[model samples]
Target: MYCNHCGANQPDHAVFCSQCGAKLQTQSESTVPSEQEIDKEQTPVDYLDQLRSDQSSNHTDSEPTLPIANKPIHRAEPASSTVSVPPSGSPPYRSTSPARHLTWIIPTVLLLGIAGTLFWWYQHQQDINVQVTQLHQEASQLALKGQYEPALAKITQATTLRPTYAVLTKDQTMIETANRIHTKLETVSSNLKQNQLQPAEKSLITLQKALDTRKESIFEQEKTLANRNQDLLAVLKVKKELDQLDTIDALAYKLDEVDRLNNQEAKEVHQLIINKIITISMKNAEKLLQQNDFSQATAAVKAGLQYSSKDEKLLSLQKRITSEKEAFELAEKQRIERAIQQAEEEDLKNRTAGVELLNVDTQLNEYGDIEIYGEVKNVATKPIYSITVYYSGYDAAGNYLFSSSASVEPYDLEPGATGSYSAYEYDWYEEVTVQIDNITWYLE
Candidate 1:
């Protein structure tokens, strides 16, 4: 048969074209069927014989025919159809072959990859930890060297890099220890700077003791850090006090330091005091000189000069005192001499006056033999004069001996004053008196 679509020749019994794979239509045969058509309706064995006969007959034709009846068809079969039907008791079909059973390999590979990654991470972490530890160690060393700021920076970096590293514990401890040592050193340094050696030394000792205790503790590093802070605080306090000190206070502090150090500077401090004292003394002396209390002022100047012997003020004061004392002595001597001369003149005046008599004798007979005498003299122009005479005599103790009187009227006297009167002599001392005008002279 010819296919109308492509004009390809096909067998008469073909339902489709072999080359183009197109469908063909069959025409109906009338009345008696053709022998080929009758043969197609045979039993299974007769059909097979027919196919063999057709194949043998078609071999002589020149046209290419479908070799469907000559060779067995080897078309690919479906997996389900090719599967062997196992006996009822046998195990079911397994698609996986023994050689293809690699279920364990994927999980094993994954686990190995995970392990490798974990190992790499662990090694990296270990390197980081080592670096952190080294950094911490360096910080500790800096702290030991009293480089607090730098050490703190290094420790801070170390902590940041490996905050929980196992090796960091020891490093942290060392860092803390270094901090404590730094603090103690700082306290000592501050004390020295402030000139408060005693207190500073005490604080330093306390810090050292604390450090010793901290060293025994598990958290020694932390303790050391605390101690360092304390030291800083102490130093800061001292610095503040020092800053506030004025000139006088600073000088006093220096003097105290000199005393503490037993240094030669002590002499300088003492000299300053001496100068001040001398100045004050001189000022006081000047005031005294103003008040004209030269004695006291001179003494003050002398005392002041003991401290400063060559002081001009003191020398001036001494000169003033010497001048004043000489003037005073001269005046005093002149006054004493005037007083003595006046006294002597008065004595001479008293001696030049004549003595006056109180009474003249009157009675005579009752006593034994006696002698009486009297004389008068003019005190003004004449040297000698004559006047009434009176006499009296008595025994050793004034017992009446003899008495007599003689009146010489209108007696004459010389120019210079002279007078003589005699009393009667008795056994012993006797009283005698003369009355001239109203005046009386006594002779004894």
Candidate 2:
């Protein structure tokens, strides 16, 4: 046998070519034996088969066996017509089958996939780098615009993307500037929270200076932003003072506002001082009034009224003083009137007396005796006249007689005049007594 692929000769009856490892085909002509060879090779099995063969088995026509030398041999094709095999020890040629090509395809696809993945990663890196640059630029712009919080956010993101960007020197400067600005803002914020207007203003000024310095150093346009922030802070402080003013008393509020204003800023400090003075004056006036010093109290209140003329309390105080003064004047007037009335009543109950007239005439003097002659007039007309003239007084019921006296003439003359005449001589009575009617007159 010969291999079709390799043309290697094989032994007869071989099922395969040994040299090329090809399968061999069986041939019937090669298996047939010649009749003489078969007769020479007959065995006892052929005689038994002839004797015991049934009619059916014999009729099946078993042909006589041929000798091996008479059998027709099947011959292989010529070597020139067979496929040639490679030389010994040479490796078999690989088939160009799709299944075999799939091995290279898998590796090629895997390589292509790896390349694509690397390319995608590179592109992603580039995109991220671009984004980082854009974010850094945006952050710088925002910082220049004085938007520190947002600028800080962008700067933080950019730093995360590119921890050490080559051009980050400027970005780093910007970040530092933003941090300084934030610190200044926080300082101002704390001062404002404490309601320290002066300190807060100072902080704002410092912040502006720092911002200006940063702008100049970095060649950024942040002065305008700094100025705007300062203006905003100023406005906020003014508004806060105004709001505080709303809740405080008028004098205190005005004083606080005046103090808050800058020295260069014109305000009504004088007016506030005057208002405070007026308030003090009013309080003093009230104190004086409470102490019952109306004269000084009125003066003080009048001074206060000069500033706050329409104050109800001042007016009420004035009214009260006027009422009190009027009451005092009325009481004094009543006291004087009562005193005059009492004096008049006392004068009406008093008693008064006076003498009308008396006349004395010719008389003789005697040893141990004296003559008396006189006319006595009655002055009181409220009673009747009783006549009794005595030089040495002796009555009609005389307990002792030293002399005698009789009325020569007597008359009752209304309340204007009444006359009587009498004479008496006596030594014992050196004085004379004359009684006209019921009125008595004594002459010494």
Candidate 3:
């Protein structure tokens, strides 16, 4: 039997636990009657009467014989007197406390439960690792296929399972990077397709910069593709700008800005641009010439000449503008000369009608000198205050004569006013005539 208090092994008849000094049983309670004593006993009533008679007889003694205490029990072999072996036919003593019976049983059940829990936990952890690994593999495959969204979802799930796992972490980063790159590429492609070159070029440049830090095989190829797309975008931009050009100056400016002429197509397009510019400039120049805007026409032609100085149409237009300008100048000069001539004729007529001589006489004076006199009048319906009279003397043969001049008496004349003039020439004698030469007069 096990000691109740300390669970130490002990004999069944032990009065006190050997390990903890706990009482196991009283001496009287531990003792069992011998089967021979039971057989020799009278009937049951007689035995009870005899056990009472003995107890009364023993109590009657002043000190009843102190019953000797039972001896300590042995571990394996014990004397029949020390051990409390029940009589051969008597039933064995059995414990009635449930707690006593369950002491060993409960621990065994607890141990089994703990072991089962540990095994299940290990299996669960293994399953989790496998699932995470499988998800990582799937994500890698999807990323390779360029299905980044689904791949990102898978990678996220795997990473959640093992946040500190190295392979999963790397895969997550790779997938995220690939997804970003794919997004940028799509944006660039869309912009390119829509002719949004500047934005597309910007995105491509950003993508190139991002790829510059990586050594991935695909990233390198993408970098190359980005560069090619950048070139293509530049070309397309140039071509678009060229297409929108409606004038030679604008096209020339755009051409100067473009740097991709080495491309065969760009070179051809450049040639076409030159031709178009020259043609448009020549046409504009022609229009300007027709409008008599010679300066603007010359400017337009020179603009075309800057692109193709030897182009036939431009040169022809330039020559035409020059010819037209020269012709125009000549016509203008002729017009001015005609105007001047007409003005001169009208002035001569006006002067002629302005003054006249009337009542003029010329004779030889007493000294045989020629004397001339006249009344000068402003015949222009205006007053006259001043006039000059001219006199000439000649022989009766009317040969060339000496001429002299004299002024009227006053210096100023009113409209239609008359002024007198007399001149005596003492040099020659003979016929004399008085004639009005010019009148200085003012209108009334």
Candidate 4:
């Protein structure tokens, strides 16, 4: 008997091959034979060759045949052929069959192939995990920097690496919200700087609402900054209102408002206001000073100093105004004195113009008074209504002794008419000389 699969020789009673472990075909289920039934004289036949002889004997030209791993000894296409038989009593041909080797090799190859595939799958999964984790870290870093758009991009790209990862969707939503808030915050800051109070206020309100809805602790700092900027926006609103006022009162009121603000931006704006006040004050006061308006100029300097009391330019301007005022007063006083003196000299010339002194004599009278007599004639075309004589008496040494004035006897002297004039001085002089000094009259 033989094994049908590997063609191994076996004992006559053996029901299975010893070499290939293939089951042997037997007449019936039976026990192993005794030594009397052992066919030691009989030779074994190769089961593979016997299978081919049977296949050839049953071969038909029209019947389809299946191929085994190894080619069969007979072609199914040939319908008839003489079956070849090995010589009797020669030890039955024993050879290793390809099926015998393939029995274990196929299973080993399938196992190795399965192990390699699993190892490759595991390594690929590890790489995807590392890449996804790296993307998550980069996205987190970008988010911390307020780079919300880039963070979103990085996290969204992580979805490409691991599309089934549901965590990335949540991260996308978070970064999107942060990006919107960041944009609004920037808008608020820009509006504040440009003095757009309404827009900035609106943006702040929106930001506050968003933060409140989220109630996220991460946005705490942004909320704090928004609140702080809101205060500045209020101050800027006041400043804007103040800027529209053209009156002196409004400007002064703005100076008063400066004390109320405590923010750094507000302080900066307040400083600008102070500078504007000083600049405007200096210009106004300087113009007034040029016009010699000392009172108004002083008021202008005071208006500037009311806000910034220690400003150097204002202080210097105040001193300049004071000095200018003093100099102006002194100059005014001298001018008035000179004007009065000129008026007096002009009046004197007008009064003495038409009077002519014909003769002037002085004598010591018995009463011890010095007497001066002068004859005055009208020298102009108009008549003098009343005549008066003025005299200056001189001593022999030519020094002035006294002045005497007296009305002439004929009060209504016609023009070109002679009139007698006399005047007496209480003191007497020896060898006196008198001259008519001036005559005063009203024109008729």
Considering every candidate listed, which one attains the maximal TM-score?
4
Cα RMSD of all models vs. native, in order, equals 24.7, 25.2, 18.1, 14.6
lDDT against true structure, model 2: 0.55
lDDT of 3 by residue, 1-444 (tens): 544445466786776777556666433443345555545545322332343444455343453332321233233432242323345433334333334445556787899999999999999999999998899889877777778798889989988989988878877787788778877887787787688887898788788888889886435545655766676676678787676789766787767655444455456667778888888887888889889999999998888888888898888888889999999989989999998997677466446667766777877877878777777766664454446665555566766567677888777666666778887778565565444444454433
Worst 10 residues of 3 by lDDT: 65-74
Model 2 off-target regions past 4 Å? 1-107, 119-157, 163-204, 208-279, 284-444
Q: Would you list the C-alpha lDDT of every candidate in the order shown?
A: 0.53, 0.55, 0.69, 0.73
In candidate 1, stretches whose alpha carbon ends up further than 4 angstroms from where it belongs are 1-105, 159-167, 170-174, 177-181, 184-188, 211-444
TM-score (C-alpha) between model 2 and the true structure: 0.29
Q: Rank the candidates by lDDT, best first.
A: 4, 3, 2, 1
Ranking by TM-score: 4, 3, 2, 1
Candidate 1: tens digits of C-alpha lDDT, residues 1-444: 555334466787888767546576454522224445445644312333443554555354554445454577443334332223323332322222222223345566899999999999999989987887688778767665556578778877887887776555655565566666655665666665566657765766676675666543333554554454444444444344544443333534533443433223345544554455466666776788677677887787677676567867667767877787678679878988987886566444323432334224422334642444444444432232345454544445656545555543334444333455544444433333322333232211
What is candidate 1's CA lDDT for residue 153?
81
- By lDDT, the better pick of 2 and 3 is 3
Q: Give model 3's TM-score versus the native structure.
A: 0.36
Clash totals in order: 21, 15, 9, 0
